[model samples]
Target: MTTALLPPATDADLAVLREQLGRPARGVVGIAARCVCGNPTVVATSPRLPDGTPFPTFYYLTHPAATAAMSVLEADHVMRELADALAEDEDLQAAYLRAHESYLADRAAYGEVPEIEGISAGGMPTRVKCLHALAGHALAAGPGVNPIGDLALARSSWSPRRCVCAQPGAAG
Candidate 1:
């Protein structure tokens, strides 16, 4: 049997990743990225200090769909469309806000809500799930993990690389 070896990290690679991170979200309203399975992952990109070392870090978010979707430009388009829809339709935005507010209220009342972290400013379910998955993956991967780290490693920005939902058509 043969085991696949993981690639080593490099400074040049980190630099390229940082450049990609610098780009602004092109009209992405509510976006999330997650591993197919459902592990919270983070992507970070920062310049190295005088010592020429990268300062990569990762954080937790609550949107698996957005997170996972971000992997592909096509999925990103879906997020963009959702954002445009929200911007154009006040009723839609209001509905999303109401749902999110209700979710938050319920959480506050219950003192615990399952998978509540993924929900962002709007009540986007896939995006929220992706964020939560990313956070969970970051915790499991380690504190040093971040957006840059994930990009450098070519791992999913939202969730663990080996997700159960990581099927070909799993992403939305």
Candidate 2:
């Protein structure tokens, strides 16, 4: 199922996001995905920031546990493995290109930014640069859209199905 954008962020939601990110979330359009405990997970950011900066990453992952999981995978050099798999699989390459197109379309819905035109985050349509960005897109867009993101999620120790937001020292 596609994860619809939540209603406009409330003051409380903003506060949680601040804590989750350890800073103010700039140009957040809405909460794209939420934790089971109702905390913001994936945030939909504007194509451009409030300060005239072209921000290409529309689906920003904010969940601390999820972010950490992606980081761990990166540290383990899983991106190299994924990249190799992509090179060997024609269907996967096609799906990844589709994912790149979908990402561009989703960002375009917010606004157009010339500086970031045709650029989707995570080195999409070509390379696996950032698993966090890919996973963010996966969580926001739902399964079957981004196969690489889904694969990373499958390999990660964290699961969005469970709520870790309330756990002590979770912080995000």
Candidate 3:
């Protein structure tokens, strides 16, 4: 992974992604976010995969701890709470809509896929569907860009500022 926003994916980076995902990573355009140890935390993927599948998730969370944290949040029904917050907060709704647009713009830079047009991951601009997607976007775009994502990350057990990559079977 390079310093550029969306550097070209390298073979070494792909290998780490494969390990994190437990499968070969598809449509990965670049490493979007990295752990303190420089391992990939989130990936920027192509709008359309190599298999011709329409992939809508541009920022895909890959870090084992981060993914697990988001899964735990989802399991705890945090999405419902977040959804309630979004419903009540007009400012949150506006920011989420902007995040949705930002996500769309990021994906559009890769290529166009009619099947996923106007669709951003994690139920943006309306609902909280997947914390993993929202957290991934937050990690990739940084704080404040995605309010829902920021909130999700805040509630999660994981912290991007720390390095859990040294854990057993995890990247370091």
Candidate 4:
């Protein structure tokens, strides 16, 4: 959350994550990105979960407002429109391919999970499946890294510049 890179997860962070998820946060490695108010926007998760499942989603969006906004976009069929754009725009397709590579590299930094190799969240590099995952990737990697993610976040009701955390201590 601070400019110092991701800090290790602590008890308080876990507690807040549990509250945010309505279940315990599993295999969280660090806070990948934070909201403007310092609440966690994306938490970097382990490639392999505690239950021995190979989890592919390394950057998990935990902020309630951000998730909700992405949900709204999904509800409005924004992914279909984005997929159409990906089909029509070669530049966007190229950028999204790069983003896919970046996501694989980032996840590999944690550990390897062969089951999920070459796979990134939100159906990246091909189609727009989930804006929440793309937005999480965007927030974690910063702008211009994930083009569709940036577009989704820009078009969404949520803003990284805003703090919509339900409570002061609530973060993932």
Rank order by lDDT, top first? Answer: 3, 2, 4, 1
**1-172 per-residue lDDT for model 3 (tens digits):** 1224488888988999988989999988999999988899999999999989999999999999999999999999999999999999999999999999888888888888999999989999798999999999989998988999999999999999899988897865
lDDT (tens digit, per residue) of candidate 4 on 6-117: 6698787777678888899899999888888776778999999999999999889998888988999999999999999999999999999999989988888888898998
The CA lDDT of each predicted structure is 0.33, 0.90, 0.90, 0.87
> Candidate 4: where are CA atoms >4 Å away?
1-5, 166-172
Descending-TM-score candidate ranking: 3, 2, 4, 1
Candidate 2's C-alpha runs over 4 A off are: 1-6
Per-residue C-alpha lDDT of model 1 across residues 42-149, encoded as one tens digit per residue = 232111223444321112233333344444532444445444555776665565454444333322322232333433222242232232333333332443332222
* TM-score, structure 4 vs. true: 0.92
The deviation in Å at residue 150 for candidate 3 is 0.3
The weakest ten consecutive residues by lDDT in model 4 span: 1-10
Q: How high is the lDDT of residue 139 in model 1? A: 38
lDDT by residue for model 2 over 49-128, one digit each (tens)? 99988899999999999999999999999999999999899999999999998888888878888999899989899899
Going through the candidates in order, what is the number of backbone clashes in each?
40, 0, 0, 0
lDDT of 4 at 84: 97
